[model samples]
Target: MNVELRYLRALVAVVDAETFTDAAIELGTSQAAVSRSIAALEQALGLRILQRTTRSFTPTPVGERIIAHARRVLDELALLERVAGDHGSELRVGYAWSALGRRTIALQRQWEELHPDVSLVWVQSNAPSGGLADGSADVAVRRRPLTEGRFTSTPIGAEARFAALAASDTLARRRVLRMADFAGRTIAVDRRTGTTSEELWPEESRPAGFRPVQGVDEWLTLISTGQALGMSSEATAAQNPRPGVAYRPVRDAPPIEVFLACWRDDPSPLVADFIRLARAAYLPG
Candidate 1:
């Protein structure tokens, strides 16, 4: 097939993003353009690449094979570009729980002022590295430090931890809390992206148990219904804002560290700029 790299990129973006519209958002193009790119690609190969249903979309048997190869090709291209010291016009900022939360808007505005030629795209993933390890993001912002030798990073800011409770809960009226206050509570925590852990408590006084939630929305839903309480970074409160949930400062809880990380071997010039911007944006007055 005479497929071009851009066409393959669009195809993979669609599948990874899970919709034509979302793929377009990531690719910085119109949904119609992304749809046309897929259609043209299928025509070139004489095979359908996607199977669409009313509620969702997925790759077909043939499409899955194509997608796998496309991803590999794109990854190689990215590596090549990185090695060549190319900071492309677009940068994808990946995150899990929250992408700088209340700082997001100011950061974006300042980023535009600092680098008007480059476009920034925020991509959310619940992966351990916020999709950086899987090549879905060029760089990532996460609360966890990058421990692997392959990655290098700097701390941008630290967010104060908060205790999330149902609005009707007795604790909701309190302005602040301590680790000891959560002794008998069953707390909901996201296994993948969350920074909170039962370890915050002493062995004997840890929360009654943990309710493992895979995503922030699920954590909020569980907390809202009083099935579980949650302790999380202040960013979670600023970003999610569920009606039934209230976030109070955890006076004695440890703060969550935030970092901007990228592959140490890649040498992407944009990573430095991102790290710098994040630091400046998050610095307290």
Candidate 2:
């Protein structure tokens, strides 16, 4: 079975991205081109590698087997290229806005100290939408897991949601907060793009009268100025606990789990090292 490297690479991109459009964007190609590559690869292999539905692409048993081998082959190829060039160049790292916490910063510093040869370039993003797709980032720190199975994820830590309120707000005096405490009160939140906040929130644990704002900064600003109460991660509150704002733990709320995700099909040693450091720094002993 003669499979071109391009086809294998495309398959890996699609699997990592979970969608044809995302895969195409990551590969700097068109969706039609990505689809054609996958089709040709499947035809040559005489076996279906992916189970495609309207929502996402799932790897078939054979494809899963192929992916393991493909990752090893791709990694070896990347190592050869690195050896041929400068092996001690810059290592680009990406993180979502919510990941700028003490733990993340400490980990980065530790990694840099351990590998002084590697220069670390940090990129901050609100979401992973184009970070990996553009090839600008080698590793990504996200609050949610990569469900598409195209990225290998390592569970790092968990963050509980807290109700952040201005010091003048009546809720600020409360020792503990509940969903009913937010009833009829203006609550700020990060607006959803494709996915709804309802999906992210637990069905029974959602706060009544909760409303989303345009962005995280806006939400923080509103809460800090006494205009509204907002929801924020414990990590966020810990990092930016303003004098006017107080963080009270939310009772009966869902916590978001943090993960270190890397392109499963891409073989980059820097990404692997970052993932290792993240696990060591954040994962509970």
Candidate 3:
């Protein structure tokens, strides 16, 4: 079967955007073009890749495998283009949310001073692997480590947990909070990319309810609106300071461990250097 790169791109865009209309907007093409690409791809593969319903679009089992490979291929193709075009060396570091919080700039500056020949690029992606699995980044910084064997992870540093509440909530007055303090509140979480989970608390005293959100913005919105509270790493507290939302240290909660990860078979040469600098950046001066 002759499968083109545009077909793969269309497949990924549709999946990421969750609809052909949105995928078209993302790809700068018409909705009909996106639809045709998907159909052409399916015809070439001779199998159903996506399950579409009135409410949602999701990948079939086989489509999931195909999409994963597609991401890797597209990533490699991008690298090839950069090399062929003589683009200078760059290390793309991906993160789902804040990249090292307040230390992001310090790390970037240090990297530039040490390796002026190579540009340090930060790519923000909402993927669970922080863009590694999707091939958007050469390396990734994550609070939740990837379990896939194809990936290798290194521990960089840990940050204390924090509680996020509506500024007007009575609990917002506290200077610090404990895990138990959240037991009575509804907790908002981004199950895909966020570090927090209901399991953090003892089963019996867990939050009143766990509401899953799509991303950090949604999580913060829920907290800020008094619809729910949230738990996250100190990095989040430092990186995102939304109005109507108050962040307080969760004194008794366990610290959130940070990790640097990359594909094991084709790891970036700068991964080690990046890890060393990241660790130093996270250090208390």
Over 4 Å off in model 1, which ranges?
A: 1-78, 81-87
Report residue 147 deviation for candidate 3 (angstroms): 2.1
The whole-model lDDT of each prediction reads 0.82, 0.69, 0.83
Per-model C-alpha RMSD:
7.5, 7.2, 4.2
Quote each prediction's TM-score: 0.71, 0.62, 0.80
**lDDT digits (tens) for residues 96-198 of candidate 2:** 4555466857876887798888887777554443254334566676666666565677787777777789988888888888766765666665543111254
Error of 3 at 250 (Å): 0.6
The model with the greatest lDDT is: 3
Best by TM-score: 3
lDDT of 2 at 90: 77
Q: How many clashing residue pairs, candidate 3? A: 0
Clashing pairs in 1: none
